[model samples]
Target: MSLRRLLRTDAAALIAAHRASVALHRSWVTPCLDQAGFEAWFSRTLAEDYLSLIALERGSGAVVGVFNASQISRGNFLSAYLGYYACVPYAGRGLMREALPQAIAYLFGEIGLHRIEANIQPGNAASIALARGAGFRLEGFSPRYLRIDGVWQDHERWALLADEAGF
Candidate 1:
């Protein structure tokens, strides 16, 4: 798998992929970016606070998933939150396990961030396992941490620091 930075030419494919993967992301209330939404949403100049990258199968050139690092803070708290979803065709294929280390490398080594956090719902064993496999440790729990699927949901905080990631 190869990581592709989101580009202007990917808008249509992203929309289609997102539509196909909607069911998988319903637990997170992820927005499906239509053309207009994509226009407003795909601004590339905000690297300081947000970053979006797509995982692609090298030979097939097919999109595997999208990984986002957002809410980045650079001051005393140098960290960001991760949000992601696997494309329908690539779900359960261990694409994340292959892609996350690369994402973590960019966040910690290139972005110069100290930590990357992923908040997961308790019942999402798959997601929790993904985080654990990527070397994120459970940090804490928050009640009503986020609004997912129109309801407040509890979440387990998971994080990986730069030093721990071999930065």
Candidate 2:
């Protein structure tokens, strides 16, 4: 697998991946997001200067996973937040393990960010594990950080510094 910047031509493939990811996340979150909302979100993401990478199957060009760093700032305290999801079939395949570091390098090295953080639902063990695998350190929990499945949910905060990320 290889990680690359998302291109305009990838819109449809990304849409498909978003649909799969949303469906999978629906079981765990509230006020599930719809395709229209996803489209708007994706469009806005693509327009950002922050990095957005996609894990593609080299041979088939299939987008198996998507990860992004948004809200980047380059002042003395440079920082950016991360978000990611993988297609159901790609889950547990260690694809994120490979893609995340690459994306981190771009964010911290090329993009000159000093810190990166991931916010995950408290019970989302899979995501928590992924953040740990990517060298993120658990920080603290936030109450009602996000609205999910129609209810406010608490989330755990995880962060990694540029040097600590080993990128």
Candidate 3:
């Protein structure tokens, strides 16, 4: 798999992927499934504080998943929050497991971030395991942390620092 920054031209494929993965992503994420929504969401990724990337199959060029590093802070706190989801045809194929370390390296080395955090719903074992496998440690928990699918959900905070990443 290969990782690259998200492109505006990816709208059709991304929307199709998200639409197809609706069941797999139910209650986990709500990606834009149309052109207008994609336009609005994609606009934010153009900002300096957000680094949005897409994982692709090296040969077929199919989208495997998307990894976003948002709300990046500089100066004393060079950190960001992570948000991601695997697309249907590619979910559970160990593609993300292979791409995550590359994403971490991009965040720590290319983006020059000191820390990256991924907050996961307690029941989302898959997400939690992904973070853990990528060297993130359980930091703590937050009640009603983020509002998803119109409901506030609890989350476990997992984080990895640049030093811990050996960068």
Candidate 4:
């Protein structure tokens, strides 16, 4: 597996995955970025306290997923929100299981963040399992915590601290 910062070169692959995974992600939050929107989003993303990356299969060069440390906050409360999705072909194959630990290490060790949180809809068992496998603890649940697909959806808050993330 390989991971790199998302670039214009990755736009097409990202869009394809986004489109293909619509059903899997429909109930999750997203901005539905097309190629142009992706370019625009990338142009503004880093400046807005977010870092996005693409994960690729080692030899095939096929994108396996996307990962992001979004809404970063520094100073005494160094932390960020974690977001990610595995491609249709790679989902349930433990690709995220491999990618997440690396991403978390990057956020905690390189980015110097003390905590990273992933809020997932309760019904997304796969996501919840992924978070748990990566050592995230279920902190609580929020009713209508976020508006996903125009509906206020509930989310279970999961988090891993720098010290506990097994980095």
The candidate maximizing lDDT is 3
Which ten residues in a row are the worst by lDDT in model 4?
Answer: 24-33
Query: In candidate 1, how many Å is residue 54 off?
Result: 0.9
Ten contiguous residues with the weakest lDDT in model 3:
44-53
Error of 4 at 159 (Å): 0.7
Q: Can you give the TM-score per candidate against the true fold?
A: 0.92, 0.85, 0.98, 0.92
Per-residue CA lDDT of model 4 for 14-42, tens digit only, reads 88877787776777646345977787768
Ranking by lDDT: 3, 1, 4, 2
Kindly list the per-residue Cα lDDT of model 2 for residues 9-41, writing each as its tens digit: 677776766566776767453211455655565
Better model by lDDT: candidate 3 vs candidate 4: 3
Q: After superposition, how far is residue 30 of candidate 4 from its true place, in Å?
A: 2.9
Evaluation by lDDT, superior candidate among 2 and 4: 4
Model 1 per-residue lDDT tens digits across residues 91-162? 898987898888888888888999999998998887898899989999999999998767999999999999
> Candidate 4, after superposition: displacement of residue 119 in Å?
0.5
Backbone clashes in candidate 4 total 0
Which residue runs does candidate 4 get wrong by more than 4 Å? 31-33
Clashing pairs for model 3 are none
Off by more than 4 A, model 3: none
State the TM-score for model 4.
Answer: 0.92
